[model samples]
Target chain A: MIIVAVLSIIFYLLSLYRGFLIYPGFLLQVAYMLIRGIQLERLPLVGPHDTLFFLSSSLVAFAIPFMFSINDERQFVGSVSVIASVFAIFSLLSRPHNIPLPPVLRTYWFELHVGLSFFSYALFGIAAVLGFLYIRNKDQETEILQYKAVLIGYCMFSLSMIFGGIWAYLAWGTYWLWTPKELWTTILWIFYSLYLHARLRKEWMGMPSVVLGIIGFAVTLFTYLGVSLLMKSSHTF
Target chain B: MLCPAYISVKINMFKKLLAFFFSLRTAIWLLLALLFMLLFGSLIMPARPEFSSLNSMPLFDWLGENKAGITWWLYGSILLLSLLTANTLLCSIESLIRKQQSKKWLLIISPQIIHIGFLFMLLAHLLSSTGSFRGNTVAYEGSALALPNNLAVAIKDITVELSPSGYVSDWAVNIEYLSDGKGIKEDYLKPNSPSFYKGLGIYLKDIRPYPVKTVLLEVSREPGAVWALIGGLLFMLGTVTLMILKIKKESSS
Candidate 1:
């Protein structure tokens, strides 16, 4: 597993010397995984190949954010975000179209549900670093970068949940199921709520907000991905 | 913040009620309740299996069979939802009435947008819970699958292959469907890919070919997608803009 992760990261980074890493590389990873699977003959749930695919795909896309200079990181992340978004559209494209349909991903609610949530997770990732920095360094040098990222993250996380709940409504017919995922998300949302409240109610600012911001984002990651691995939801793992 | 010395029982009752419905106390309680529930799901209990097929009983079904257990879960979640709804609604309303004069447009509008977005989401869930939105998948070359809630999917054709090693090499599917004879269409879906018609979508599940080849698909729909998107975009923009404006002002100063 460690080797696969390393390989995936390497391929993902190498693929970036030019553009478009996950898509073409994804096909190769899939093929390699299938061959490995045949040797194992039967491994359940954690298809190592598919896991590699997902890891590489996510990391490569996430790397774009850090790849840019301070001035250019936003554009770098933005451009890659646009390109990676194409895969989502392509998920709807089944040329001459002979791909077996997988469950857990078939519904519009599920798509938008998972899609918006992941975007929000990515958004949180961007926001989280700033919040972490704010909580760490109390100096003025990091203040501008700190605040900007938190703002972006807060906006994205809120939107993600609202949209995700709406999509859940479409799929599961419930706005909030209080599933482990839902529960943790609400906890995360509440942490943000407290930060907002502290800002207005007590004139709390600076590191306090950033501290909460950092905590909230860690919870947000759990809400999106960690929950699948560590918790349980009606939604697939 | 301060503690009042003493109060009459009646006033205290009112205060507690007010606190329960509007205070952070209620929100925390709701959040805690969900945490316990989630822990139950992950550690002690399991979420009910969503019944997509008749051959197996899902975990949800088994737990729900306890009758009282299902009721507890539902009521617990509702309690949380109600508290959340009240918090968001009242906060927004109070702001609109009390702070409208000094209100920052972004703050005022963003909260309203988010609150109403939550309400709409609740409303859509209400509509769907009653079983209004229903759908199924149909493979191009397979028979119709009878599903619950008066939904069915006809598989048009599902292609499957295995490499010499035996793991599945590829899976492809063509599907068709109709509901109330009005909403009907056909689509081709694959792994990580989905196709939609009449508000319903078909998603590829898994593919296997050994003794015989098979493809699986899951179908779904949601009536509140547009509202969610709208709320999400507005909220994101509002927060980011406000933060940026503050940062810029501070820098210039």
Candidate 2:
């Protein structure tokens, strides 16, 4: 897996120089990892490493479509490839040595819940990158792309929260427990909501909306990493 | 018989207030205020175990007593969220009234549906805050638990499955809902699946193998759960519809 990540990084960099589509390397790597997880007889959400690996794969998977849809998506593709490679490296470094899936986690709801949530995180992360690049370059196209990405991510995030509530009710007998992770998730949702609302106003259309997108991703990072590492909650995985 | 000047003054003031409440700027500011309050609550309160209970408890109950300095922020957040809710509702209504004559009514109306859904969820939380009941009970084989409204829950059996490594593979507990000492329904409660009885949700929280083969059951009834569920579905429906319309418009343009 580590070798495959390195190969993906190499091909992604080559794409920048060669101006050719070389994302198949990343796709192959993700496919291998997923097949490995399936062979292990569990979803790819068992631990921190598995979760990060899934995020890396999902980010690359979602970002690939943009490359085909837009003419100037090479830079975006390369950036996502770099970010995905980093996630892959982190997953390799932090992976545990053969831990079995716990009984509590052996449910379809758990898989659906985490899978949807993390994939949405991937989309938001891409939007955040676009936001940052737009700030630096002052490009109208990047700004529009950022908005679209955030909008789709917001919808996915909403679904993830709904699925999470259902999973919570089934497992813990309540729709919400106000855990730190859950609270932060709500905050993240609200942050983007503010961005979308601000988009309706002419004064906030240019720089301020992009700033919100970048800050929203920072919140997303904290929710995914900080909450899991720092807090004592049922979602600590 | 009313003075024209007085009527005009009152009408102008009402319009100003309506515009203020329905303004996007107001919604953004209120949302930011609510966000800041929630950030404060989640970041500061969880560090201290004593005040951590504030997270799970209602804001009104928390404000009834002092818990360091977090209580004020919590109260402020609750007030801000209430204001935000009112803003959302007013904006939705205002948009509905204005867009009644537009051709793209569905495109405009879907977002209002989403706003109404959010308010419904707020209502659900409000109702649950005052009416919900949650408690834990230990159930053994043949043990009975008396409940409200002349209802009861009786434990029928317990089953535990262990892997070759002696780790617990799975566990289930059979429960029978009794009304007037008559069995009305039976269910097997597992980890991710809870049993429902007369609006009460029964969850098998834990299992004890060596200690009398007992099960820890958590029973709760959220009177507002149905409302919340409907709100969630509506929210999803409205969001998807809006997105589809937005995409179509973008493509056409």
Candidate 3:
């Protein structure tokens, strides 16, 4: 796993100049996840290590589309590669252990819930990068792309929350739990919703909305990692 | 006949209030307020022991019984959400009425659909908060437990599979629904898989196999489950449609 992650990061860095090497890098990450999943006999999304690996893979997956669509491909892809590499490094730092899936996490709904949530996080990650580029370069196109990324991410996150609610209801008989993790999830969702609404106004279009995009991703990361690590909740890994 | 000065002023104030509730700005501000309150509650919940009782019962029941400084954030959030709900309804109504003649029907109607879905979700939570029932019971094999509505559940069997490492590989509980001292239905419950009878659901929370063959089962009745599912579906549908439409429009332009 360490060798695969290091190779993937190297390919991602090489893709900054070559741009085509991203495909191989993304493939390597996916292969690693597939191998882990086959070995574990379940989706490899139970702990921080696997989840971070999944997030890094998703970041590459989402960044692939922009490589062809955007004009500032090098910068955008480079930013994504850097962020994804950091997460990959983080995953490497955390020791991996093979454990059977707990009874509570054996449901298809839970798998879908976790999968979609990480994918949405990846989208938000891309949006934050775009927002940063826009702030640096004052590019109007980057701003527009940021909005589009956020719109898509918001939809996916909403679906993820819905699946989570359904899973919770099935396992615990309540759709929503009053836990710190759940509360932060709602806060993150509403923060993005506020961003969406702020984008509708003319004055908030350029910098304000872009800043929200960046801040929203920070909130997303905190919700995904900080809540589970710092606070006591059912989401503790 | 001319209206009195005070009456005219009062009518103008009422109109201002209506306009405020129907504006997008109000929606944004209310969402921001709710977000802040939720953030505060998230912090306070971990630091305060009083807030731990939040999940012990329905939300309204908790609110009615516990009045403490720690819960002020929740109270404030509920108020903001109520106001936000009103704003959502009025804004959707205003939009539909104003855009009634627009040629882009999907574009015009998509946001309203989302609003309706949000309202339905809020209603689902409200219903569950006020009327939901949750109870936990431990039952051994062949033991019968009584439920609401004169329904009884009999534990028929329990299965626990242990792996080589002595970890629980799989587990399930077989149960029969009895009414009037007769079995009506038989089903099995596993983790994340609950059995539903009428409107009530039975979930196998845990199992103890060695000392005694007993299982911890949780019975709950949520009146809002279906509504929440419907609302979630509609919300997804509207957002997807609106996103597609926007993307197409942007690309074309």
Candidate 3 per-residue C-alpha lDDT over B1-253 given as tens digits, one digit per residue, 9 for 90 to 100: 5669989999999999998998888988999889989999998899978777777578889888876577899889889999999998888888899999999999999988888888899999899889888888889999999998899999999999888888887898899999999999999998888999999999887888888888888888888898898998889889889999987887676
Show how many residue pairs clash in every candidate, following the order shown: 28, 0, 0
Give the root-mean-square deviation of each candidate in angstroms. Answer: 10.3, 2.6, 1.5
TM-score of each: 0.56, 0.92, 0.97
Please state the CAPRI-style docking class of candidate 1. incorrect
| TM-score top scorer | 3
The deviation in Å at residue A130 for candidate 3 is 0.5
lDDT of 1 by residue, A117-168 (tens): 5555554455455454445556443444544444555555665666566554
Error of 1 at B231 (Å): 5.3
lDDT of 1: 0.51
- Model no. 2, DockQ: 0.65
Residue B130 shift from truth in candidate 3, angstroms? 0.7
- Give per-residue lDDT, candidate 3, residue B201: 92
> If you score just chain A, what TM-score does every candidate get?
0.55, 0.90, 0.97
Supply the TM-score for candidate 1.
0.56
Q: Write the per-residue lDDT of candidate 2 for residues A162-214, one digit (tens) a residue.
A: 77777777887777776678778888989988998898899999798998888
Question: What tens-digit string does per-residue lDDT give for candidate 3 at A141-190?
Answer: 78888888898899899989999999998888888888999999999889
- Candidate that would win on DockQ: 3
lDDT of 3 at A216: 93
